[model samples]
Target chain A: MDFSLTDDQRMMQESLSRTLAEASSLDRVRKFAADPADRGADVWAALTDFGLPGIVIGEEYGGLGLTLLDAALMAEALGRAVTPVPYLGAVLAPLALRLAGSVEQQARWLPKLASGQVTAAVAISEAVAGARDGAGLMASDGKLSGKALFVADGHAADLLIVADTGGVLHLVDGTANGLGREIMTGIDLTRRMAELTFDKVAAEPLTGDAGALARLRDAGWVLLAADTLGACDVMIEKAVAYAKERKQFGRVIGSFQAVKHLCAEMAAELEPCRSLVWYAGYAFDAAPQESSLVAAHAKAHLSEVSRFIARTATEVHGGMGITDLLGLHFWFKRVGLNRQLLGGPERVRALAAQMQGLTG
Target chain B: MDLRLSPDMEAFRDQVRGFLGQHKDRYASGAGAERPREAAMEWQALLIDNGYAARTIPKAYGGYGAEPDILKSRIIAEEFTAAGAPRGFANQGISMLVPTLLEVGSEEQKIRWISPTLRGETVWCQGYSEPGAGSDLANLQTKGVEDGEDFLISGQKIWTSTAAQADMIFCLVRTEPQAPKHDGISYILFPMTTPGIEVRPLKTMTGSAEFNEVFFTDVRVPQSAVVGGRGRGWFVANATLKHERGMLGDPNATEARFAALIDLMKSETVDGQRLIDNPVMADRLMQLQARVMTMKFNGLRTLTASITGEAAGLAGMVVKLQGCELNHQIAALAIDALGELGVLYEDGPHLRAKGGWQRNYMFDLGLIIGGGTAQIQKNIISERGLGMPREPKLAVA
Candidate 1:
């Protein structure tokens, strides 16, 4: 028995890592983050050329028909580069549709979603914090009447799949009547978030069973966890690199055991995340029974570990770590945001406990 | 990649399971650590008879000579570990000496030592750490002066665990005192009963006399006693360290410890509420649980690389450092969860989980320090694992 990635998967990983390393490096990410309207169009175009958005879409829908794990790899690279792209909303929203959308809905939307012709945003949170069990938006007669706060890439979407108070989904067009958006300024400017208000906006209802919303939530957790994994990877790598080059008291910082131990401790905490996110993503596709528990585990554990790594990584950079010049804060802020995105450690572990039957 | 074993491997697993199912009750009475040498050897012989002992040894050496299939080996480890049957002697013989011998021993040495060691006829211990040379092992002062057809060795080795039980000690002695430190050391072997040898048992901080200070007052061994060539002790010792690293933290055993933790949380109560029901406790447990799974997958990745003949490189070092830390954390977490009972030892009936948590906490300290200290591990990782610049050596004068 082997748990290593397939050759194809490894090739995909290497190619994406190389491209992001080249095109969406932190310098480029800073350039994009400075432009309020910029969502890394050049890097997005490169990824579109690589057909990343469609990696998990069905073959019949003009996509690669790979698994959620394949898409999670892209998420990791994007997170590592801190690239400004609406991957979860634009790429993964299609999978949500494919999971719960009607046959005609799939026939019409899947190809367009896979081809990058249409972009979608996911509106799953209502408060500054996340909505519980996908229950927040209220819907009646194919019209969404409540708010979906913190909508990812909400302002740029051509379509939006909205989760409501009953943990059901409602699909709305971007140009639909009576819909308004107040763009929110988040610490992580690379990825955009907005407060979307649906004033009886016209939307089409999808098949929104409890199982469907749970899968969407699980997918959300896995994607965010994968992104955090990526952030931790780069933060540790960058910190270690800085330790070797930066000097203090006539010795390189790494020569000091304190700095060396800090770097080593970061590795110890972050290395486990590689496999945690991997198996979580794998469970999303191949082992459905293991998906939720592992996803919760990944999210909760990485939420805390990535935060520690982020703070320690910044500390490794010393005083310059907090400044905008070195751009180390990009990774630090990315991890900070990802730590609280869907559910932080406390919330996620509560869900995990319920799943394990440890709590009533 | 798929985690399903092939049918052949599956059948092999079943064979091991069925065999253990039949004989599990015999010799399962003794804890593996407490099993006497003869009883342990008898169990080892039974397992050897069933083609499980010396799993990687060649069939020419009365072993099954199984191919280097990682899963089958894991299966043997899992079953033998579960059935309470001793896998190998609780000493340095199986894990360290056997592997190093296969790599560099003479064919005669193999014939004379390999089978008997596998059959548990000989118990081996290591004599590497001395009182003054614990972490800086290369600075050992043990000397071996060449005599007529023999080397007269005079040295004292400290903290030699299992020395009382070991039939032979695989040790290092400085053969050329005037040469550079690492260059003068040589790996040698001799029986514990040799003249001028003395073993004084020392109780460890954990309150066990599991270690000793072994002194040799001009003990003699023939020139052929060196395992590898003379003045190659450091290199051979590193080889043994590799095997020790691989064997130190078995992830499956960590998984079992976690399971026991969950069981304790399920049964134990704090302030009339079950421990698992506490949010802080549950969160901590969940985090450690995730780390355990990651450790398992990392292990699988290592196994896959070995099976597919890829260069695992410093992956072994990564596993060693991370594995020990994980084991240590798991033990520490258990002790923390035990609350008041954490203060007690395993001798008391009132202690939680029979005070296994405290006992394991003591054991994890050895794992962290043995093979190499955590600081030494970081040195290796920074120098070799990450290609960072090595620390500049100070003037030795």
Candidate 2:
């Protein structure tokens, strides 16, 4: 009857957090964000050393074989540092493969993906859910065509797992003959997105049914929620630290009830979200019957609450919050992008309503 | 991360279900309606005797005397709530004062107070908040001047719920005039019917007089009535306040209310369509569902932390603030779903759910303010939980 992280889970988070703190500092993140070619190679190497990319890959495939909860923890650490590395893809690609891939397919890519020899990105927008600009992909006759937009960490991947219009997942080589990839400048530079065009590119369909795709979507929601939780935590800490040192009217602004309440409100609203994300992640593994609904709830609720925390935490900083030099915008924009990445709060809530049989 | 109950705990749940099944008719008759006091007391005593209530208190104090097991306690609460059975008495006496007595009371005080409170033989009202000392409770000027072996208490306490019906009151009073505000106080207990005591019912927005303005004018009680010693009332009251906050923000109550809201949405119709079927209403319901689920999981996390002896920190601190606000939002949404029917009060012919939603909407507002205003809770969360600087003290003129 426990609903908390195991000691080993806590240690894993701490180790990853320590590694990110050293390897993905704000300067390093800025450097990566500013450079079009860097692609956070150094940060990815750090994560590889920490064995993060394979946290959820099957042990038989030369990977760690951990649960979605472990992967969610890694996502949280990445979000906390706002590290400019390709983690969302690193986690989700393996998850989709494991959930839907054939044994042969798993054996082919799992080891490379685990060892960071190959990086993968997922293109599910307009497939399992709606995309902002009606972006989509189509598959036929062992070939993929059409465009997939908002592909997270897509520009520099060695492999691409694209979901078709019918919610079928297909694996495509990044360097396929007819494939084209273009970077899409997004608000969050910590994690990049891309637009992929597939023109008769050869692809292999995952053997499993749509249930795997749905499970993969649920995992995505939980991971996004976990990431939002970590981002909110850092934003609140940054705001509190700033308020403690920033003086106004002859005293630390933190001593003012207004500033204190702002910090307090952020903490209050975000604290419970930790449990929500944890439960959603736990449900993904242990309570499959409830996973989809809980994941939707976590995603929608955190999307709303994280916006409040982000905006309010920034407001707590007054003018410095808007300045690029303060770098609060990194977290601010990270949360902004997370809010809309898979599905914003409204879309997610609508899906949850449908799942509950409340919508026609 | 495991949420599965152990086989032993599962067996215990079956035992509870079996017991409730046998006595189901005894309490089920008045499931949602208010029961007669005598019948309620009988039901409470049966529960205490069966180790369902007061499960951890010693038998000498007329309790079940079981070891404290959080999972078992949660199981009992869940089964009892599910069965529509009254899970013994809950009030200022039982939830707040009893725990304080168990922690810091004299043996005599415990023996005299714990059993009756547990058995619903006595009801208590808290006398802590004053007109000038609400958020600043330490500024209370309720004086208890010593006269021989008794103290003559004089003060006014507002927002005292159930004061008009209470058998006794656990009160805070300043006993040392020269000492600092927080250090000069004492916590004392006395009969509500003591001399010079007056209770004026304070009708709230819910159109009921559940609370009162309790006036203590030269009320005399033995000095021995003081619990946890003199000059320690602040600390004792703080302990009881913790219990009070917990009582007000019960996740079980919120869950039950949310369930009722869903039922109402299903049953009520607008424009000949079920409220639950409306797109806008459904969206709102799902949003609230998300928050409600958060409260449930957060409660589990807190319970796990308690069992594992880990510091819950901010998670524990935000419950009252979040729970109260979420409950109020649920009730508000219920009323909104009712449409024009929402405006109907208890006396209205078309009133739905016996005006429960309306009453809850108003009553939950009082709850947000009563235990501690949302602002005070935010202060506590920020200052204590987040290590933010405290609000600076104002200079004396």
Candidate 3:
């Protein structure tokens, strides 16, 4: 019943906050941007060594088995830094696998994911071309063929969790026969993306049915929401601080009513997003049955708000903000990426409305 | 951080609900009646006698002295409002004036006022707004000159709600006119029945004389009646207004109104379709429902912060403005729900649903203007909440 974070959780927040603050420094992110392959290995190991990927993984799988709140705290830290790590691909992908994969699949992947030895991506989207009235790709006969657009960190991942029209998850090797991966140029360069082509890719079925895959996708959306919430938190702090430090009309610009109002609005927008994300996290932790609705609520709310806060953060920073003089842009891009990632705001909202019986 | 109530609190809620249920029909008629003050007072006394009143009042005073876990009291307040009991009018006296007195008044003041206030012995009305001092309240010209051991007050107050029924008035008077606009003031408590004091009723659009124009002509009150230090009236008024902004706009009123609207929509039909089944009405309801949810969340965040001793400095302004705006929107929405009857204020052949929509629509107009103008709240949001610069004031007259 307690809404307050525990001391352990607070420490987790602080530790993550500090780690990202230093590691995701403007210099660090700039260096990574300059050499994309020089990826955030140090930060990655530090987070994993701290048992981040295993946050929701059961202890039986050599993981911490903490709640999504813990996962959220970790995501918030990543968001604060706009750090370049495939946490969604690294953590959520494996968590999804553990949730929906068969015993044999879990045995093959869970330990590697827990130990940070491998990364994975979930492929669910398909291009809407040559479509019928109710067009969707079928996943019968085990072999897989279809292109999953905007596969996050697809090129870097070791495994791929693919879902088809049957709502079932098919686990396939990243470089399996008939599987193709193409890196795409994206606006938020801090986050990489890939187009995954599966030409009847060799695959192994996971779990008994696709029902678990649906659950996993919803959980993934919540995590994506958690990630965006984290990014928004960072943007608010950055904008507020910038407002205080940057001056206009012979006073600190933060002293101006317009800037103050903007920051306040951002703070307002961020708090609810945080609360919604936490509620989703709590639901995931306590009530698995209601997770989908909460996740939709969180994702829909966070996507719009995080995007707003990011834009406001940049606008509040003025010209200095445009060049990445401060570390603000990193968090800004992270939020922008999150808004479009895992389905845009409109899609998420439509899904949420449907879930609420509003669409029906 | 937990928003959930304890078992004890839940039990307390049930007990309160049961008591309210028992007496619901007895006090159902009045919307804002003035004469039968005793009916309301007697209800307060009953609540106090049964330990159901002043849930947050300190025990040292005549209250149960419960440590204020305000959410519980808020829940109780909501139940009372939902039950349509005018018995909760003493809320301002208990929730606002009493707390102010406790904070700034002497021990003697608390002894003299807090207990009886809960018992509904002393009704209070706020006297901060003046004809020329609506949003710019500090420019108030109500004067209280020092005369021997007392202050001779001569001034006028506008938009004073419930003044006709009030036993006393908490006023913001100009004490040091030569000082700066904000610094030259004092917060005083004066009896409304005293000599040279007048309360002229101002009829509202709702057909009720709920507000007033009060005049004070050399009304002498002892210096002991000042709630806080002289020339500190601005701070005192701000504190009281802060309480109003933070706690006054209970979601209970709107929530009850919304629930009723939904029920009516369900039972009624337009063009042979249930009102709730119509997309236009359903979408509107969904949006309002979303707003209500956000307001609830905002209340929780503010309440949690207050409990943790980190008050949200200007977010209160945002809450107040949102409450008023949403209330007005909901009223309009209700009118749309009422269809043709919305235009009729009386029970006529053309009227429907007892003409409640027209009454509500008119009543909501006063809500935004009375507590603080919506524009003033926006100013607060800009200057204080947003740290925006104050607009240059016109030269003082």
Candidate 4:
């Protein structure tokens, strides 16, 4: 069977990687983290030019009708560079909509999203942890209430793909009446999070079934898994290179067996993390039945593995791994933020076990 | 890029699966097909008869001549592994020697060896690790001195799996003593029945004599027996190792083993609660399943890398290590979760699932040690995969 990437997809990945490497390197990420409000409009426009936002939108929506795999490639690149764009919120949210959204909803919002003119965030997480079934948010009488905490790119978005108590998806304007936002200080600075308070705000349903909210949550989890996989790679590479260059005990610390073992563990964990992302990505694109389990596995594994890599990487760098000068912490923060985002490793692991039919 | 398989390939996978389904009753057995080598040999011959052996070999070399598709190969491996096929027996011959031959064997070599090896007419074992050269394989002292048309070899090789059963061997010997450690090595192929060869089986924790200590007292083989160039055996061996590690991605095989363990846990109660229902056991099984799935996915990523010809050095060194570690973990978890019943062997009256988990727990040490020690894999990734500096070798005065 042919598992190879098409030439266009390969070039897309290469150009995207090159752009991120040149314009939004770890150094650039560190700079952006210092000023989160300073959006990368030029870079975002470059991404639009690169068709990053339009890769998955249908041609009828003024975008390329690319598969989920294409979006995955871009997500991975963004993850590796720790690029501070709401690409996931902007791209993945729409892609999920196209997959599970209503026909009219697709007709209404797809073009604006495909043109990169609007950014959106999916509000699935509630005020408290482990609230799986639209825990705190309630939607009734064409009015939405309750709050969604840690709404990614919440403050910067033009729209919110809101999931209510009944699990229907609603496309709500960011400035809907009674909606308030409290910018939350998070471990990751490049990506902003906010506590969104919806005080009976006007809402519109995007998906009729509440079950689609689960799909949205699952898709979002897998995307984060993809992103964490990328961040893990960045941290691993940075730590390894740093170890090779930084000297201690009259020799490169890398030459020491202890350091060797440490980096090897990272490599070990990183490899599996990569595989999980791919399988989850493949499942997301191809197999629906296995996607939830695979996604949970990828997310849980990446959550733990990326954090382990970051921790080990920082240790390998000694004092410098923690500092902004090294820029390794950016990846570390990204991994941490991703880990805590939808459901932490504990939640995902529990879900994975249930999916595997191993629940007690 | 199209990650989807072509329709023909999909049909081919189905054909392979259909064939496996028809013949799975024959291959179904426990993991302990390690020694008494006849069972493995017979199984290998059956695979050859069915054209399921040496799957990656091209048609001219007595293989299916299928295109290099890692996913297809992965599916075949997973199906066969699920059927409890003897995977260890094929490790050296199918996984290592056959692939290396495809990469570097001469036309004469391919015609002479590849077909027979794939046909199971010639069983093979690897002779790489020695007592003193476990992780540092290049430090092996096995030497072959040239004498006219042949090379006289005299050395000792330890930890050679299937040595007693192997009819042929693909070994590395020191051909240039004065050269650097890596440079002096040569990969050689020879009949195990050659003069001066002795295979002494060594019993392990599994209570099986599966491995051997082979000694060669001036063994002679023709110059043409070398797989690649002389003094380049290190590279050939490395190539073989790479192939061996790549094919080790079927993590779902553990599913069956875990199934067997769960069955035992169902019948046997622990603390008045079913063992499978225990929170600790449940948590451990769940974690193991997650890790297994993670490893499976990692394998897919590496397969993608292999299919695309991207660099997979990191992928190879890491996934297998993780697999081995997970295997060990699952085995231990099975034992602990079994309570007192976990310690019994197959023949015991209190035997549970044929004492498979106990045997597997003991046998898994070899998996970590055979291809490369977990420590060595870590070192490789740290140094090569991660661009870390190499660890200094102990000074040889």
TM-score of chain A of 1: 0.95
TM-score of chain B of 3: 0.87
- Among incorrect, acceptable, medium and high, the docking class of model 3 is acceptable
**Alpha-carbon lDDT of model 1:** 0.79
Per-residue lDDT over B1-397 for candidate 2, one digit per residue giving the tens place of the 0 to 100 score: 9999999999999999999999977782212212227777888778888998888989998899999998999999999888877777777788899999999999999999999888777888899999999988999998999999999999999988888778899999999889999999999999999999999999988888867899989999999999999999999989878888877778889889888888888888888899998878888999999988999999999999989888888999999999999999999999899878987885667978888888989988988987889999999998899898888788988
Positional deviation of residue B166's Cα in model 3 after best superposition, in angstroms = 2.0
Compose the digit string of candidate 4's lDDT tens values, residues B35-134. Answer: 3245555666666555566555677887766555667666667666655555423546766888788889899988888887765567788899898998
lDDT preference between candidates 2 and 3, better one: 2
User: Which scores higher on TM-score, 2 or 4?
Assistant: 2
**DockQ comparisons of all candidates to the true complex:** 0.64, 0.86, 0.24, 0.46
- Which residue pairs come into collision in candidate 2? none
Candidate 3 lDDT by residue in tens digits, B1-397: 3446789878888987898888765553222535336666676656655555766677677777676776666667767766766544445666579878877888998888888777766777889899999878899999999999999999999988879888888899998989999999999987889999988999877787778999999999988888789899899878877677655455666677777777777777778887766666765665565455556555665666676777655444567666766777787887887677567877677776677777767776777766776666655665665555564445969
Q: What is the TM-score of chain A alone in each candidate?
A: 0.95, 0.98, 0.91, 0.93
Q: Give the worst 10-residue stretch by lDDT in candidate 4 chain A.
A: A126-135
Top model number, TM-score: 2
Instruction: For candidate 1, report its TM-score.
Output: 0.95
Candidate 4: tens digits of C-alpha lDDT, residues A81-149 = 888888667765786577667888788788988889988887777521356434367888888888787
Tens digit of per-residue lDDT, candidate 1, span A1-360? 776778888888889888888778877888878888776678878877788778878899988898878778778988888878778876557866787888888888888878887778888764224664443678888888867777778888888988787777778888899998877888988888887878889887778354776777788888888898898888888888998999888888888777877777777667657777888888898898989999888888888888889899899899989889988888888877787777778888888888878887
